[model samples]
Target: MGQIERLADLVVRAGVNVQPGQGVVVDSDTAHLEIARAVVEAAYRAGAGWVEVIFTDGPIQRSAVDHATVEELSASRPWALARIAEWRAAGVASIGLVGDPDPHLFDGADPARVAARRHDEVRARRDAMFAGMRWSLVAAPNPGWAKQIFGEPDVDRLWAAVSTAMRLDSADPVAEWQARTATLAARAKQLDALELTAVHYLGEGTDLAVGLPPNARWTGGGLIDHDGIPYLPNLPTEEVFTSPDRRRADGTIRVTRPMVIAGQLITGLRVTFKGGRITEVWADEGGDVIRAQIDADEGARFLGEVSLVDRDSRIAKAGIVFHNTLYDENAGCHVAWGQSFPWSVEGGLAMTPEQRVDLGLNQSGVHTDVVIGGDGITVTGTGPRGTVDIIRDDEWVL
Candidate 1:
């Protein structure tokens, strides 16, 4: 089989684990039509009852942002929400092909509108996340993404890097993932054993304490759906993460690497927090976009996730910044300020919003991750017994 077809098969069989009689949703950009089509075909081959493709056109989105009223843009298209709701009720699987071809398509538009989000849509999607949706996100290489990485459209080079990151370079990529995910799962168990009350990140201008409640569960590798079906929610996964108490983060953190938000690259970002709420945020580039994202909602200013990735990550080893969160966030330890994964907390999935808040879980319409740990960093866990190191000098020690 061709590489794309092989990749599609992996996405269908392992990514979301399309089951017999299960309907599937494939989300893609216009630039990734081929990959989406391949995934749809693969899903059908995997005995999916039906496969649907949802396409997004970047240029048209740019036009809307440039001319559409904020109210018009904020509706998030009720028809789209209806589709998601329909899929949600039917228990459909979702697969997304990312790696936008034009990261700059929204540049120069009103950053406010560019960052404007529909809370209704965000809440609906979050409701289906993991258990309800059984989703996976994988990258699709294209000329624009390649150009951003290498200053030229070298799709072959981009594909080579993606293949390596995704472990497709191995003779048995699926087997390799099984082995690697086992290791990550083992590490997660160790962290869980620690019964950590909080995790401390110390480095350069960073000395942040992210609170991990007693019921917080650290999860890595693949997620189990409602039916106990295992599915990889993200390809090239490397971080063991948990939903932290959104009310406990404190200190300053210097973003260690660049991150992309709303098709804009943010660099040299530094943020300050007090009692878990973001008090200050600044980035050398794309500052407006990042700031706007922080202002998306009240919950957007608090911590949702704290993750640790060792130096052994293939994405970091590749020595190339994919400029995509799917790859870059795994390059090292990262933190997200927005909606926390419900399953990351024990019983969180079934908790009402009020109950979640009582447990310090964050609920928002936003979830943006920024890398904060890499070289010269120290990660430690502190609990009732004492404190122990988890990662040092980019190596996992727990």
Candidate 2:
């Protein structure tokens, strides 16, 4: 098999663990037809009963967002999410490919409308999966994504890096990944044992404190299918994570790196969170929109995820800051707001939305990841008892 085919097969079999007679769903753009086809073949090879593909085009969606009506924006599409939810509820498998064909397709569009038009149907699927199901999200590294990272638009180079990052070259990548996951899981367990009260940040123009919930548990790596089939969320991932105390985030967090959010590039973004609400936002570009979204959604103002990626990570070593989540999130320590994964909390999957809200667990349909760690950033942890240094200069500290 060729590199792309081999990688796709591995992702379906090892990363997602598609089961025989189970439904398989793939989400990709037309530009990724080849890879998407490979994924379909791989799912069938794994004995999937059926494979469904969703082709999403960036330009078309951008056109709709830029010109669609208010009714269209708020209109819910239950059918889309229903398919995935039913599949998962029936113990189906899912694999997704995220490779933006037009990184800046909606760069000039109204950010408010762009954010508002998202389908709530998809949110149900996300909720169901987080409630306990099987899924995996990988990237195709298409030319458009490459162009977003490298001005020359080097698709081949990006693919090569992605292949290496995903470990497609290894003779037994599944085994290799298992070993890596065990190692990282050990680190997460160690951190969890520490029972940290807070994560403190100190760096260039950045000083923030992110608190930890008493029930917070350190987590990393992949999840399992409904039938207990295991899978990885991001290929080449090397980070340990946990859900932060959503209501306890305080202080200022300066954006040390640029990020592409909702089809727009946001630079020099600095946000101040007081009592878990975004009180201020400052950015050289695309700041107002970021502020609007956080203000629009209920949990968008609270913290959802706290992650730590070491300098030795594959993405970090590659020296590429891919604007996409598949690569950017693996590049370094980052945090997410809006939606909190139910798997991150104990007995979370069984909790109702209202119960989750009472426990400070957010359930917004949106989940936007933004980088906040880099060179010279020190993260310290402090509770009522004492203080423990967690990260120094962007590296994990024990």
Candidate 3:
């Protein structure tokens, strides 16, 4: 079989682990229809009872962002949220194919409007689904995205890098992924055992500290649903992450990778945190967008997650910036603002939003990750045993 066919199989059998008689929902943009179709076929081949595709038009979304009024931007489509809730209630499996064909589609749009346009109600429903349902996120490379990264429409070259990052080059990709997941799980176990009070990051242009909740659990690779079905949240994932106390972050850090948030490429980004809130934001470009996003809600300015990745990551070793968070965030250590993962803490999934907030878990409609790991970076963990190296020179030391 060809690589695309193989990828579909891997996604169906390994990523979401589709079960017999289960419905599958595939979400993708027009640029990724080819892969989305393949995923549908693969799901049916895996005995899926039914498969549905939801297509999103980039140009239409860009138009909305450019001209929509504040009321329209903030309005939640109840029908849309209801559809997702119905799927979740039916135990449906979901597959997301993401790769922006035009990463800068809304580059000149109003930053504040763009930030306010996110569907807050839909976002909350999605978060609830994540706590209970099975889903997978994977990439679908296209000519436009390839051009953005390599300065040329080299689709084949881009596919090659993606295949490597996804471990599709392995003789038995399924077995390879299983082994890789085990390794990440072991690393998470080690971090959990540390019972670290805080994590300190030091590097050029970066000096920050993040406090962890006592119940936080570092997790990555695959997660099992309530019914014991294992699902990989992000394909080509390389980081082990935990939810940090929303009220304990301090100091400043620089973004090591360009982040494409809300259709804007933000570079040279530096953010200052005081008591876990984003107190200052600076960027060579797109700072307005970052600032606007941070002001989205009361919780948007606080830290939600902190993840660690080593230089040995497949995405980092590939040495290509994909301009997508699912790929870039895995390439290095990163931190996010808004909406902490419930699965990252003990009994988190069952806790009420107010209870979670009281325990220092951030709550907002936005969750944005900014990478901050590279050469010269060092991370140390502090606990009852005192400080110990967690990462040195962009590699894991623990």
lDDT, each prediction: 0.87, 0.77, 0.87
**Poorly placed runs, candidate 2 (over 4 Å):** 383-385
Candidate 2 backbone collisions, by pair:
none
State every prediction's TM-score relative to the real structure.
0.97, 0.94, 0.97
Runs off by more than 4 Å, candidate 3 = none
Off by over 4 Å in 1: none
Taking the tens digit of each residue's C-alpha lDDT, what string does model 1 give over 1-398? 76788789888887898999999988899999888889988999999999888898889888889998777777767887897788888999989899979888887889899998778887888787744688899989999999989999999999899888988877877788888889999998888887899999998878998888657899988888777888898987999999999999999999988767777778899999999999997878898897888888889999999999989999989988888889999898999999887777788888888888888989889988888878888999998779999999989988
For model 3, how does the per-residue alpha-carbon lDDT over 193-225 read when each residue is reduced to its tens digit? 888889999999999999998778889678988
Clashing pairs in 3: none
Candidate 1's error at 216, in angstroms? 1.4
Name the candidate, 1 or 2, with the larger lDDT value.
1
lDDT by residue (102-157, candidate 2, tens digit) is 76777778777766745476577776677566778888867888888888789888
The 10 consecutive residues of candidate 3 with the worst lDDT sum are 117-126
